[model samples]
Target: MRALGSNQAADPPRYNATTDLLERNLVAGRAERPYLVREGRTWTYEEVVEATDAAGSGLLGLGLDVGDRVLVATRDRVEFVFAFWGAIKAGLVPVPVASGLSAADVHFLLSDSEARGAVCDGASASAVLPATRRSDVPCVLVGGSVSGEGALTWEEVCGRPASLRAAPTTEDDVALWLYTSGTTGLPKAAMHRHRHLRAAPSALSRQVIAMEPDDVVLSVSKMFFAYGLGNSVYLPAAAGAAVVVDDAPVVPGRVEGLLNRARPTLLFGVPAFFDGLSRLEEARLPDSIRMVISAGEALAEDLFARFRDRFGLPPLDGLGSTEALHHVTSNRPHDVLPGSAGRPLDGYEARVLDPDQQQVAEGESGELWIRGPTTFAGYWRRPELTARTYSGDWMRTGDLVRMVEGRLFCEGRLDDLVKLGGVWVAPGEIEEVLRGHPGVAEAAVVTSDDGSGVPVLVAFVRREPEWDGSDLPAELRRSCRRRLAAFKVPKSFEVVSELPRTPTGKLKRFVLREQPSTRP
Candidate 1:
């Protein structure tokens, strides 16, 4: 296991990610193998390469220069893949944003990225069109009528003969930009180099899953997210496996249908998605599925037991971030611990440290710091933040965790901790206890100020449909009293239809903290 700080050559010095991922298959005589399956259609490795080549040529012809930024706001489809690799092949930085963003949000991204052009599907064109127009950048429609003047359809741009030559990009050159979820504040762009794409597959996919060329993968997350990008694009390509792409929303019944149709050997989803699937009477894992990976947020122990009992395979919970390309630490297939995030991946190193930058004792919770080959170069245009986030090569993960018998157990994020009555409390501890109670489907804990401006804990719970709500709050309080300190107990329990989440299924805890507390 080699770390990035070591002076060794994991990848060649003059490497281009697009050229390497696509050309390797052809070199290995796998050009005819199926690489992408979407909506009943499949594309061979050869076909994908040609499409990406054409896409690169088309973008270069549009007066976009090398190193220019191109925003890709499209749904999870073949076209999104094409536009992404195409820009990278042309030596242009591709910034992929969520397809479902509002017009104003899209405009903000366009301006922040200073993108020279954009690619959008019909579903997202309404937002991207106005955003690109407002930003004065060229727009290319992927799969719909061109509604705006000067906007070109994908075919019109890439129909001509394309040059097979790829841009000269080194391993250290910026390949793409992934934006943070903005759970705490405004979104920040993390710049990843060409070599970073090769790191995750080697460490997590190859080592933990033992992924093989014959395996097929399916994910509920969209390509814009870092987790989804690894699952659908780079990881599969590196492993020489096939990926099933679905643009449909993640409904339990719909995912079940997709499972039956695709028969993927491995599935990737967030804990919330797995929880939803566990509730459906019609949901069952296809016999082909061998493992399930849970990410984007921590997986509760109760939900993990329920999923394992229902599906017969334990969900591998991992912790990763946009700063790292994908998972740096993850639970392996056969060595899973229900609530732990597992050990660091083969090529990554993790350490839990105190506020003074000294390593904490084992089993003592502290801030997590990780150093790995997949670490991002830095935040785009935010030098001060980047400086504060890194110490030499180690990147602060912003997560609070403890090491127990070689496994990493996450308590919560440092920013989410609530200081109640002069004692710091981890909300996850209270939420876990609340979730362990019967009929509690989901729980999120946030801080609310009491009448004297003292911070107090408030829990928002989503209960089972059949569970009686009469006196449930009092019962929940009693449950907490038995398991937690009095200060750690939530002062109020508010039952809601659903908790707020980001597009990628991450809890928007800030939204909960901002709402006026209904304290009694």
Candidate 2:
């Protein structure tokens, strides 16, 4: 029996995101290479290393230590990166909050994470950090007035010596906490370890995106989101590729301008981003972008086909979560699928499970379960949620999915199903059919209770200019009916001038549902 399988198992890999993340690029004689570009300013790998060291030393000077959680809230991507790496180097866990979060939301995150310190940009100080009642927690302001506020300024933080002591850490050490997008409810912090940081980038940078050192990446997803964090930070760092930094909200015109300036080989965004860009009605694809990535929401089939028609390549629609640290499954450049999430990356296993947690048969839709090295350790301080979501080594992803021919297709959230006229209807199915209509640019479906409190389906849509709301709502309902079961057809369709979406491009369905009524 081949000596009983050699009588031993293989050892696990070792890595630390802090000390060793970008070091490979440095050691490979690429230290002098441009690692990042922003506002016409480029930083070499060596320069970033020095700044990271200085920032780490400054944080240490602020009296933070190992195991402390430091909340970093900043609009400056450069400053955010420095703080992120610096906190880890100082043996601290970095909590990166979205810059767009409301002050109350930011405060709740800080308080919930039990953070010992905060680093905020001066512009965001007023909104991100109020008068904290926790006197022990220091608020360090960057690009703002730090005087008398008891906050250390950016100038002071980077004033330390570049040659600073690097903290010793193990693969199991906590590196950072990414807050959930909160599309469902209040945001919760998802903690990831140093080793977890190394997993996704490996499969994504080297295998999926096939990152070349000369490749430039422009990501609309900010570092606060796991998708952004992996693409903007880990993917580039591990692959020795350069990235363009812009913390501004992703507008189509702005995105085009970024493309003209950055000349990136790869562009990253979410579903709504591509939808907005497609609405720009440009007949041609951006000249310089070789690839495009879409995540954060289901990539509608119509949007995908339209994008591919112009771009010459299908927009790689991937399904990732804050809990998984990034994309556990994604489309490969060679294996393009319009609306599918592609296959699981190396070192990850994915399955579809029914309500009973039993594995669903092929071609059946159910909740997605993923087991991977990149799976987050747990949600911070929510033991019950953690228990409900994680089973032993498997993490329960809230998104529902269907598998066909070894490809994974996201079907929106399992909870998004609507019971219409005593039958279950997937809003995603109706939305997909409606979006295929030439008159509809985008469509979002939500359920409202009927007279008896039986949930009824409603659609909020953004119509194409040609349609101009000229009886298009009726056409959309007809389209849904022709393609869907009677129960799946929306009871009502309202043409919203604009459908609400989060900054990261997730449709704000909860906001739509909270409306007094889903009506004209």
Candidate 3:
């Protein structure tokens, strides 16, 4: 890991300040390199530019205009990138809808975003078709079998022209709308401008990762998510580097294989992925990997130590949200303080503030507030939410953190803070301690009812295969009693096979709270 510094030169305004910037880079031959890879097939930047132009022309031919939203629900492939860039070329706002979403959830996103069109892969085309049809949005099927009417083939659309007029857009024009799962059940669409596209590469990429033009970057997440979109796609493109996209599920074995084959200089993944990869003690990775970035969830110290021991590099932990587009603060390899998210990157400012919005003293936990170029304009069509979250230019990240020596250490989410015996306790602290237990493979703590209808701290644990669960509950309670306040210890423990998690690997605490307790 490298230290975050201000040595990188300022990025040119042509990178993403305007809608036509990509076209200019293409014509100037500055973007002529391999941009996408799939099953040994590589698409050069020139080819990608040409494909985007044709796809943009196709969308324009369909009469889509600037600011019109196009929903994209597809697998990770070269075509997905083509459609993404193509929508930008056409001046259309592309909104990514996750394929794993339920049919009802999909419908809500399509209706809420008011998308005029959608593109989906074969596996999910059937499910997406009905939602699009109900919303009267035109559908285009990409990889899967498409027998539906009023649907266009992805191949046919990208073969139109090599030159399409770019949509005229300013720095404030919304370039993309990303929907993230919210605590309240429905997802929220965070609107990002063309200028926000430059945030990751500008602030974190060159400064922290120090990715060179020849470096290959690999991300475990998909491009649809902000984490993957910026780290995997935009960062490499902005730096004239290469990106390796594997259109497969991000399993531990597959991730190892990608590292072996691509020999990526940088790798980005969530904590769960790192934990899974750490399980394979015999798996050897290429020495070319210079940095490993962890985000989307708190990185446990145990996982961090295990990863460092195996890979000989500290996992650079960072905290980010969809509203901020990507990470606002990150721990660089050399300056990483175990369990700290590191100091704010260049051009960004962060502070811990109390509920009254007053800045807290150092080492005192408070809500994390951030101000930077990467922050999204607002949630799409939700003025109230925008007003509540955005104070002036600062974004109120619901997360709580404590600052020490200019580094931010995550405490937990405001929502995750529970009142036990009239004292607030962070579940993350308990979970972190439980993660250190030899018998525990994974753990999630949530406040729930005990059959008596009284609130209590309940812990769900995934024990190691060799651990005996019959006496595990008592053992865990005894461990907690010795290490934690009596009231803060869990009232009950439920040994589960696996804890439910989001696609990005964040523990779904809400799901755990809803689980039926075995204790009466």
Candidate 4:
């Protein structure tokens, strides 16, 4: 078992993640330093500390006991930040879910987490109220319109004494629960400890990005995402740096607006957002951006080259998961492989193994397994599934990857591999080839059931605005034939306005697989 990064897992017996992230700034005389900048409003470290203190006290005053789970569903706003850290500060576990989920979806999370309390904005409240009503869970509403039978308004919560003492939590104590992106099935909550939060800063951010106190980070992902939570919240907090927050939809125009306004030193986004930025003619990346990190999905080599050609900087592609908390393997600033997820971070271990539980040779595809101090403890309330997911201390990441020269080239999900004519094919390879075509703006390949119930390859393509579909199907076929084997080429192509994606910007192949292909 070859491990790439250092092992620096030493920590104090008793630790509080929220306290470690926030109080250090004050102790270092950075009380007035900007912590969160949104629109024209800037919250200093002192201000955030005060607000989080009040929020913590408020949750405690609501009769919520220590170790209770609190569902935090809100946009990427200051209130969301306060509620999350505040819960941790008060010894409560915060389960942050995507705010864009439907009412029924939000309800599922509330019940699944067995939440004792919920903090939501108006939109999230609408999604949460019906469920909380049935469960009799206490609700605290923040920002925007507040309405619910027994829900406490943000103003009402803060009306109480605005002070709190950090909880006496051990390093191993559960600090938060992050739900997985349920692309394959229902989402499962990944339990993380206070110590896990402390490890990522040293492991990835500090060593890979060289994050410093004076830097400002702009993350296009919402705070609900594992990538966003690390990039926008804890990493910045741990570094005593500032984060730019916004609830705006991640369109190229809005992202450009943020880039021009925030002038962030670092920009964190997914491959889709990066692709969008590369397409927008007027999109401007400021000179202040020292690094751009891409994750959540595999970054294509063509997209990597196009982005580099358009902008002087190439995106440092990386791989991380909800189970891993933050980045496990990442491309460093100076040492980067465009299409590959670079070496393991400063304190993590990664390995590729075959189905027989033996290590695979270099350049051979296999399941990627990772183990680190910050790896999530277990799935909440699912012991059997957790047992199956872990092999000793190593967590099976479910990702298919090949290691070459210590860099990982991620193929796709293990479940996503399609077998056609007895040969298994990776959809990412076909999709990457399709994306290389000049007329194709975006592409996704999935196995769909034929009329006889046998699965066949179907490609869903979103054409560029200027493209005419007159000869695209034939052109695309030729493109695929030139680049891929006969068995790997998509059997049929379906031109669509948009490709289905999850809230986190991951392609929803399951959804695509279920939909029928219209074009032959």
Q: In model 3, state the lDDT of residue 424.
A: 87
**Model 1 spans > 4 angstroms off:** 1-12, 159-161
Better of 2 and 3 by lDDT: 3
* Candidate 1 structure quality by residue, lDDT tens digits, 5-44: 2224455456678888766788555888888998769998
Q: Residue 454 CA error for candidate 4 (Å)?
A: 1.2
Give the least accurate 10-residue stretch of model 2, judged by summed lDDT: 1-10
Instruction: Tell me the tens digit of each residue's lDDT in model 3 across 1-520.
Output: 1001111344423223323434444645456666666657877777777887787777766667777888888777776777788887677888876666666777888888888788888756767888877777778788655666767777676566668766655555678888876654678888887778855677778778887667787899778888888776667777767778777788898779878987888889988888889888678779998888988888878889989998888889988889888888899867888788989999899988999999999899999999999888787778898899988998899998999989999978998999876788999889877877788989989989876666899999998776655688788888998899888888888989899877666678999899988953
How would you encode candidate 2's per-residue C-alpha lDDT over 283-399 as one tens digit per residue?
Answer: 345677888888888787778887777567678877788888888888888897777899988888999999899989999989999898888777778889999998899999988
* Residue 212 lDDT in candidate 1: 78
lDDT of 2 at 214: 88
Supply candidate 2's per-residue lDDT for 253. Answer: 71
Every model: Cα RMSD to truth = 3.3, 5.0, 5.3, 4.1
**Candidates' C-alpha lDDT:** 0.86, 0.77, 0.79, 0.86
Pairwise lDDT winner, candidates 3 and 4 = 4
Model 3 residue 506 distance off true place after TM-score fit, in angstroms: 1.5
**Whose TM-score is higher: candidate 2's or candidate 4's?**
4
C-alpha lDDT of residue 452 in model 4: 78
